[model samples]
Target: MEFFTIKPCKTQAAYVVEPKKPLHLDLKALKVPFDITARTPVLMAMRIDGVDVSLYPSGKMLIQCDEPECIAKKVWGEVA
Candidate 1:
């Protein structure tokens, strides 16, 4: 299934992903596996494939990196 759509943010060198549904992520469960160091009910932050990822329970994600838009798709593939 297609889990997310990637779009360039108004800010230069950044991208956003809007998911089809709210993401069901348990930070407690993901901590060890994902190496999540800090999180709250609404926000989770981590690194994936050397890229910084900020995920929201609302299913929106903000990815900041030097890679192109294709990198967002790659991250979605891994997360979804």
Candidate 2:
């Protein structure tokens, strides 16, 4: 199955990536290298390459950058 579906954001230079099914992620336990700017029970916001990235427990991500697809691939890796 496809790991995620990607679409460009209508109001910004960004992309939204979402999994086919909900993914329960522990925001407090994520080991991402980016500096997290905000955190809550349901969301984690970080900065990467001078842009904003918002992660959700439901396997949805909003990435604002010039190459969002590339960043998404690197973040989630090769999922079958």
Candidate 3:
């Protein structure tokens, strides 16, 4: 599990989505816990079923095995 990029906005966090490969299925985003603020930028890249999807900030990501355990993975991240 790698990361893309993390950007922030005034009211909401900004996220960029760029899949390493083209994906058209369901993915699971794990919102891991972190000390950073909720509004902080988070970059993440998930390999779901051999596919990657770019998740925008505040956007929703599908989960794989089980859901993440915290807010860290919940927030959207940029896809690099």
Candidate 4:
């Protein structure tokens, strides 16, 4: 598993990681109250079934914060 991030630039909100892809992510430091397409966003990589989630940072930067579990569940359908 590997982490994939999409730095939000007022244009992109989140990266649609194709289904079945292994993307590792730790949403313990993501911003909050961020509109789906308003605040900056990051796309970490991970597998659906089960695998090691590898973390990787994005190129763009912004006011970083922990990714909320509630928001993750609503957006990604799951949170880690």
Candidate 5:
């Protein structure tokens, strides 16, 4: 099943991805190539391919990238 939905952001060059159902993610255990810039109990921020990405415990992500769908798939794939 599709893990998440992708929608264009109101501003240019951004996208928001959210899980289909309520989801809680542990940012500390999530493995990605990007560096985690700022992290807290509820939020984690990182940079991927020169774009900003913010991940929340609710399994929502704000991606400032030209190809958000690709990034989303990569992320969800890892988590799943």
Candidate 6:
């Protein structure tokens, strides 16, 4: 899919890609637990649908899971 890339993982699949535009996420507002803003504003630590996720300021993201493509589409679709 346009929003992510699928790759094989030990336990499942993973996705790595960037969005068409940068995401404007408010860590404080969202209460994000991880930090990547000092250098690249990368929130490379999060979870959704039990899958580990990472989002970067450059609009890049890494989604790991079994069937990452399907999960990414579902997640992005709802978020977008």
Model number with the top TM-score: 5
Window of ten residues with lowest summed lDDT in model 3? 63-72
Residue lDDT tens for model 4, 1-80: 12344333354443322223443444445433333332222543333222212223322122222342223233344332
Ranking by lDDT: 5, 2, 1, 6, 3, 4
Clashing pairs in 5: none
Q: Write the per-residue lDDT of candidate 3 for residues 1-80, one digit (tens) a residue.
A: 23333333234333332233443332234353332222223434545343333333444343332222122243333221
lDDT of each: 0.63, 0.75, 0.34, 0.32, 0.77, 0.53
The residue pairs found clashing in candidate 6 are: 13-65
Ranking by TM-score: 5, 2, 1, 6, 3, 4
Model 5 local distance difference test score: 0.77
Runs of candidate 3 with Cα error greater than 4 angstroms are 1-42, 60-80
Candidate 1 lowest-lDDT run of ten = 26-35
Give the per-residue lDDT digits (tens) of candidate 5, residues 1-80: 26567887778667889888756777777776677899887888987667788888877889997778777776667665
lDDT of 6 by residue, 1-80 (tens): 26533455435456565556656654334444333333323354566667677655444557775466665565456344
Q: Is candidate 1 or candidate 2 better by TM-score?
A: 2
TM-score of each: 0.63, 0.75, 0.23, 0.19, 0.76, 0.48
TM-score of 2: 0.75
lDDT of 4 at 70: 25
The top-ranked prediction according to lDDT is 5
How much is the lDDT of residue 13 in candidate 2? 76
Over 4 Å off in model 4, which ranges? 1-67, 78-80
RMSD of each: 3.2, 2.9, 13.0, 13.7, 2.2, 5.8
